[model samples]
Target: MQRIGSLPSDDSSPGWFHTSRLRQPRPPLIGDAQAPWVVIGGGFTGLAAARQLALNFPNDTVILVEAQQVGFGTSGRNAGFLIDVPHDIGAPDYIGDQANAKNILALNQRGQHILRDLVEQHNIVDAQLRHSGKYQAAIEDKGIAVLNAYRGGLEKLGEKVQLIEGDELKEHIGTSFYRKALFTPGTMLVQPSALVKGLADSLPENVKLYEDTPITAVDYGQKTTLHHPTGRIIADKLILANNAFGQYFGFLQGRMLPIFTYGSLTRPLTAAEQASIGGKDFWGVIPADPFGSTLRRTHDNRILVRNSFSFNPDGRHKPGYTDKVRQSHRLSFERRFPTLTNVEFEHTWGGGLAMTRNGQGFFGQLRENVYGALGCNGLGTVRGTATGTLLANMLAGKNESLTEFLLAAPKPNWNPPEPALSIGVNFTLRTGQARAGLEA
Candidate 1:
């Protein structure tokens, strides 16, 4: 039996979750329950796994457990891009080997297709799912060079891209802060909280979802048992889709890094304030530098600025961390929109991101009757869904190409112990952010 050590306990409320319409969360697990399949974590991966399992095994019972409401976790705290291409945050050019990049693109596209279908089928209008594409914008010369390299890589992959600059770029994004940008029309933007909530609410009837139920311990075997505060679950098979917290379950130790990224959103801009920035109603911009700030104009006329990374092994941030990060976000936002001086951030929050030394994620059987799909690097929105769906398909004995591809993917490399790991990670993050300069 493994005693879970830590769980996600963010100190701030995500702007995405705060602005979303509130709904009654599914009741917490109570007493005891038994199911053919049990999934831990109610984020993107667990939700996808539970839904797919139900679809694959209609007669079997699938149970999904969450420590909090579905949209209140990391899944709803992202910049809300359903990226359809390779977005390796560790890579200098956001592209690795050509062959591997192609495979990743296909997998991400598959995930996007799955989500698009669900949004249409369920009529989840609040999700704000749109194929708005996205821009990789650069402010400095160094950042511009990075964007040029990224554009070259995309063109090599036979993907369509457009270069927008000067007045034209300002007209589109309402920001003269960027010197140039590479626009790719494959990525989809969304209200991540709404999307995850919709997916959870529309889950198949065979899949039972319980909220605010944190697994306290686990006994792994042919028939695994998971214990919570007031309830226990016995299942023939168990899936751990909890990302970095998977280490607490006695797996992926010393292999995964729990990193936190922060974001801040302003209250909806007034009509006059919106006109001050002459641009489209909504658009998203990713910095050319991986460590730089990510900006978005929401459908309801608000600006979101996301940046800063921290090494937090406990899967939680310290008190006042969000306030510190929000200061940095304010600088980033002000630099881009100097005219919106009076605009203030209404919400600021942070989310955990699971990373690995080699940028590889764990996928496949971890032990007897137990499997895991986690460490999504920084692209959890799409990668998490893809790996989760593929994992369920693999368990169902579906011999599809994507499933095989995922099973063959490399796992995270081991990291040095303790102080050394922390020291190295902190140094890298600080230096990277410093180099991002005005981009941040």
Candidate 2:
């Protein structure tokens, strides 16, 4: 089948995490290389997969290629919530079926443990890793109901969760705007770009990393040959870890929805502005309304706000998208913290996230001699790492229920083409935002 999508240009995101430190250049692939395994993409999933392969087979060569720098894509553009619960953004209620929810929770927990071990082992202090849990806050009565349902869902899975409201919610979040909130002690937070960069920098000796090397074409046969302008990678096996970009390779084409979410970060607050805010030094909050905003306060006193989604099937965003997003973000920030009106956002950017209509994603073989673990929905950090590590283990001949689930999870449902799909998704988003009301 002919490929129908173009490679995304380097993201124009001005992320705070990457800008905080100087970036060391990683050399791109040159000439040609032969390896037993080749993994595409340099995000969390790809990095984790490459790491697993190197760890499992020290004698075998593993090659990893990226179209851009390691964390420059969706991997680095996220708000960095390592959620350990089911967060099905497509569901009528954010939580899905009970059995699947429990299973997904288990998967998330497993992935969290793996990442935590890596963070500790590598001493990834620059990532600003935090074991701090997340707050699911609701502003309106509808939002409160949603939070209640979410808490009930967690209870059904025998998970511990604390539901707070009124003064309790205000005291915890330092905001009277939230009427109710659910605190789950499992979510972890980090500087997304830093974590991915640290992981790439600490890869095993058996793994070769090729940055800024976009594969222009792929010739799949008994062995897959990935062709880049500077070099080619010929490997006995191929693993797709590019998430939504995998659709371009005819891996779950027309199944996953390629949507872009927008985020904006404020410059670090001065001590006066920080005191005006009156909250803790750091906290992360995921909105109770799926369409509402996600907010985070950084350790350095900067605030990050994520809200807004647009359907971009080809992974290309319009030129004026960020301008519009910045206005929305400014409004969101002003509404939440009137005290810090002078604190303006320093950066605004968009990142692609693949959404499945049925809340399921592809995580198995897509073609002969080719394997994939794409579509993290919105929970890419934990789920992507889990799927990538599990993909490596699956290829290394490991089998368990989690392995089976990873290999056999349902693929994304088909979406209509072009303008029709775009219209439908935007309509759904608008309706959700309307329902979200003040929460948005």
Candidate 3:
């Protein structure tokens, strides 16, 4: 069938990952090729699937295609918190049912463990993997209430968490704007784009990676055919890892909402600037309200800020949208760090997040020979990785302990089409931000 969405372009959303060290380029598809399995999209999910497929079926060949370079898409644009707890972005509080909360923790920890091995064995310096816990901070009373509810829920699940209030919270974040915070030890921090690139670079020899190659069309049958600009690929099995773009391909169209979230990274802080806004050298915080801003202090001393969400039905943004987001980022930065008056954001970008109405995703066989995994519901880092790894195992018929739990997890609920979707999503976002107030 003909493709519906465009390839990921770097023109509009240039991020800090692009400014990082140079990487060896991989050529796009140039000729016809046949493989036992073909995976589309080169982000965390696709790379993980390709790696597992190659390792499990060593005798068979696998081809992985990327519309843009690895990490140029959603995988690379995230704020880099690998959360290992319940995080439903649409809800007031992140916690949920006791049994399900435990499952969420186990599933995320499983994904992080796998990623830790890859980072260590491959010596992926770009990942900058750190096992540091994450902080959830709240400025308003409503946000503080959310944190309290979350803490209570975590206690019910028997998860370890530390509550910080007043002076303690200020000392930890170097910001008196927050009145309370919660520290969850299982979460991790990493440089997202680098992690995806490292995984792609360390893939097994049996996997052939093609970058800058966008799939123009795909005809599915007993043998699926993928058509690109320069060539075509025929594989016996197919795995779809393109998250938000899945809607355009007649998969998860009515079941997922493709939301665009914006983030900006500041130029590395000067020595004086760092001292002026001092707390810990590096730290990350998630807002108590899901709609509030997410902040991070990079090891290199740069401050990264993420806030603002819009429903981009087409999965593409007008240039003006990004400029507006940068302005919002600047306002948020100035509000929280008045002491660092001269700080400026060097890069601002937006990425697609596939969210489902029920906070679940598509994670099993959608067709006879086609398996799919996407719709991370805004927790893409750990959720995407865990689901991607499970996709590979499911294809290979490996029923590990977590496989059954994931397979049986709730699926995405159907959503309305354009006019209604546009209206509802925008209204909800605006209402949330309004309620979040300064937290936003």
Candidate 4:
């Protein structure tokens, strides 16, 4: 249908999450022709859509193919924080269609519930998932205003959120930097990579999954075809769930600019150390300041921290780490909890997130019935899940609510290094960092 930027078949993840976390049997590709439905990208959105389709429509043969193993993308490599609402700090403007935005939000909440039910029903213990509330802390007056405005809007808009300020905040999260904070109790945290692996393993036989089979080129038409090295996939419909690193699909790349964010996990703390920072009961996030971070404690007893942003000129991993922008984004951690100075991270990693020029998640037809979803911005976990399903449903001729609110196609590839993304990213990040400091 639409075109995506070029992406390499090889992935860039260090052996961090894979070695220690994700555990799913990588399925091999049988051949080019699969069922009428084929989904690309094995991340949460892709897998979710794949499983949902097979469960809802048992007769449809669904094939899901991934360039690498499961949970290999940002979906699995992400810091383990799950906020129920489908929202991005920049979403108000990014999602210009208000009706669509509302539907996106509702769908995200439903997805969260869907995940929770699946984890419980299947007893997905490897995910080590836990239900812990998350906080949107206020760093300054403007930040507080933003949180309050969001809280007010959510409350008026019928979003299930509770606003806590002043002393009430102390009872929830012990961060003093926040003058006020908004709380969402329905969120759950998980070992993201593990969760993805678990989901993939739970797929029904009707949903064929393949790894190590990368598509060399995507030939789209009434019946979309994906070309692989030894095989090809010809399906009645195709769905591209690649957010960042989605460049490989001729339809995704420059259409959605990929931006990177860094995250580090702290070694588990002793009882004394745990008390020093607040207890290990929750996760926290600041408003969306491009560099803004979201953090949480995992069921494995480690602190999973995510913050800061990065860009690779090559659009792949940079060689030997050319530059280090901020000394330590953990400063936000230290400022909020001084005791973290003594804490150390067992591992640190980062991943790219995709976004379009307009900031909306890209969805809709590429051609006759084929569809693509991209641009999760910062909240792709939920947004991707929402878009992945919406796109799948559209191909199936089921849901049209999201389609109705979808926006005009953004000027393709206007944002980046797909043709020249690195330069754009470096310039935009520097400017954004400066602006954030001034605003701070």
Candidate 5:
């Protein structure tokens, strides 16, 4: 029933938007279920963990529960940038210590490799795998200095990054506003919904997935029970991959905040219009806007413009998602590329990224043996993928080096206690939007 809005179970995993690939039929549900481990959330991280568990430890039972269909949240709604290193949109949020930092880098690079491998191994038809790198473009005067400073972080990671200036910037992204830029080649782009469906299809047969089943309650301890309106899943162990929605679990809610982001694709440009913008090769661009606008080109020549606005663009929320936010990405895109304003908004959607106060992601065991991973902070393709792998390893048995480092605090510290939760998120969002409105 949810169409052209934020992803949610049964709500809007949607039949709309630029072609989201078809997915496998939802698995039959079981009442009072039981499994060795239950992953609550059918998005990327949950599925990734389930797939790995079935492959590596086939004997162990894994059950994935989603409120709606697979790839129902950020995983399905992402702009499909399977990126690698050097882009610090949200990496700093997950790496709290030296060990955490190294793990973050290693796993992200691993995610890049993993994404390609999945397409090949599974023969995912919808996977239009292309190795299109990402370009960072500067708009205002201060943007150049900000990018130069960012280059330092890229260098510290020892990952390869190419900076674009003058002619090259014009060559890649013709906008004159771009004074400086950065490029990383390993970033692959795909149709997010299709990629998600492909991943779901590849999930192990033994690992059951239930759609249209919203988890209403969590009963913790050795045999944690995940309760739904019509059924329940009782598992020996549990892994929380619910992201911003994990707050209902009580232990995870305030640790990280939920940041909302949106994206829109223009109706395919005609030959002349496409040429006017620049070459088709300049597909990906993200200007460091105060609210963060991301741009990309679709396979069929549509231009995808995106941005996220939280209750407070820079503040907090119960780590989760909402579909009701008023869309401003298309409006902002019109301002950035006025000539293209007439191009209709082919799609308008938003997703929430789990975020921490210090910009570090939270990982590790939530309770005794129950492991958890969330807080991609808008860089999920790489960060979420990597964290999923680490969580799997940690849950498997003895802690891997990466798992040991991240276990320091599996969730972010609680949210501020001043106003009510809902009130707080909206207050910040209203304030941020007010400021942006004034500046505009």
Candidate 6:
């Protein structure tokens, strides 16, 4: 029996979740329940896994359990860029080896298409899923060098990219802070909370979703039994899609690192404020430096600033952490839109990213009938979806090619325990942030 060390909980002010049109969450699991297939976590990966399992095995009941309400966890707290290309934030240039990069692009593009179709089919207008593309902007010469290197990688992949700079770049993003930018039309922007909620609500009939039910313990055997507060669940097979939390289940322990990143969203800009910025109504910018800030102008006239990373080994933030990060966000926001000094952030929150020492994600059978799709590094939105879907397909004996590809993907490297690990990670993060300079 593996005891879950901790449950997922977020700060009170998740910008995306609070702003989204959220329905009442489903009731928690109560009493005893049994299912042929069970998936833990309500985030993108678990939702995708459960949905696919239902589609693949329509006759079998699939149960999905969430520790919190849908759209209120890490999945909903991202910067909302569904990148379709190789976006390895851990890599120096945000791209890997050419062949590996190509494979990643193919998988991520497939994930994007799957999500796009779901958004359209469900008419999830609130999700604001748009092919608006994204800008990779650089604020310093070093940052620009990184962007140029990234551009070269994209060119090698035969991907289309446009370089925007000076007045033209300002015309599009309303930010003179960036010296130059590379725009790629393939990335999709979304209201992440709405998209995840929509996916949950549109899950297949055979899949049962239970929100606000945190599993307390798990006994893994031929039949897996999960214990929650008020009830227990037994399943013939299990898929762990909980990402960083997978460590608590004794699955990815000593391998996955739970890194938390923060985001702040300003209250909607008034007409005057919008005109003052003088750019496209909705545009998203990813920093050229991996540790730099991410800025987005929402369709509804709000701005989002996301930056700062902390190595939270226990999978939770310390007291007052979000407040401190909000200050950093304010600086980033003011640096970009100096005219919007009066526009205050309405919400600030932190979200966890499951990273690995070797910059790889886990996807395969863990032990016996237990399988997992964990560690999305920093590109969880697309990578999580792709791996989760592939995990389901693999279980159902479908999409063998993609399944084999995922199986062949490298596993996360092991890490030293506790104090030593935390010290090293913190030093690395601080150094990266310091190097980011004005980009942060």
Error of 2 at 151 (Å): 1.2
Global lDDT scores for all candidate models: 0.91, 0.83, 0.83, 0.64, 0.66, 0.90
lDDT score for residue 329 of model 6: 94
Q: Which candidate, 1 or 3, would have the higher TM-score against the true structure?
A: 1
- How would the candidate models be sorted by lDDT, starting from the highest? 1, 6, 2, 3, 5, 4
Q: List candidate 3 stretches off by more than 4 Å.
A: 10-12, 89-93
Question: Which residue runs does candidate 4 get wrong by more than 4 Å?
Answer: 1-5, 8-24, 30-33, 86-101, 165-171, 221-223, 244-247, 288-290, 313-315, 322-327, 406-424, 437-440
Superposed Cα deviation of residue 297, candidate 3 (Å): 0.3
Model 5 lDDT per residue over 337-402, tens place: 677767887556666677666556667766765777777767777667767877787666746665
Point out the higher-scoring one by lDDT: 1 or 2. Answer: 1
TM-score of 6: 0.98
On lDDT, the stronger of 2 and 6 is 6
Least accurate 10 contiguous residues by lDDT in model 1? 87-96
- Could you tell me how far off, in angstroms, the CA of residue 435 lies in candidate 5 after the best superposition? 7.0
**lDDT digits (tens) for residues 1-440 of candidate 2:** 24335786634765754565566748998899999999998988999999999998899999999888887888888998998988665455556677777779888988888888888999988788898899999888888878887777777778889987777666666566777789998899988888888888899999999888988888888998888877777989999998888887877878888888889999898988876657667789999888899999887778999998887777766678899989888988888888878888888999888888876778878888899888878888888898899889888898668888765666688888878877899999879877788887
Scored by Cα lDDT, where does model 6 land?
A: 0.90
| Model 6 residue 27 distance off true place after TM-score fit, in angstroms | 0.5
Candidate 1 structure quality by residue, lDDT tens digits, 194-300: 99999999999999999989999988877999999996899999999999999999999999999999999999999999998989888999998888999999998
TM-score against native, each model: 0.98, 0.96, 0.97, 0.84, 0.84, 0.98
Candidate 3 lDDT over residue span 154-234, tens digit each: 777788999998877777778877888899988889989888888888899999999988888888789888888987899
Clashes of each: 0, 0, 0, 22, 17, 0
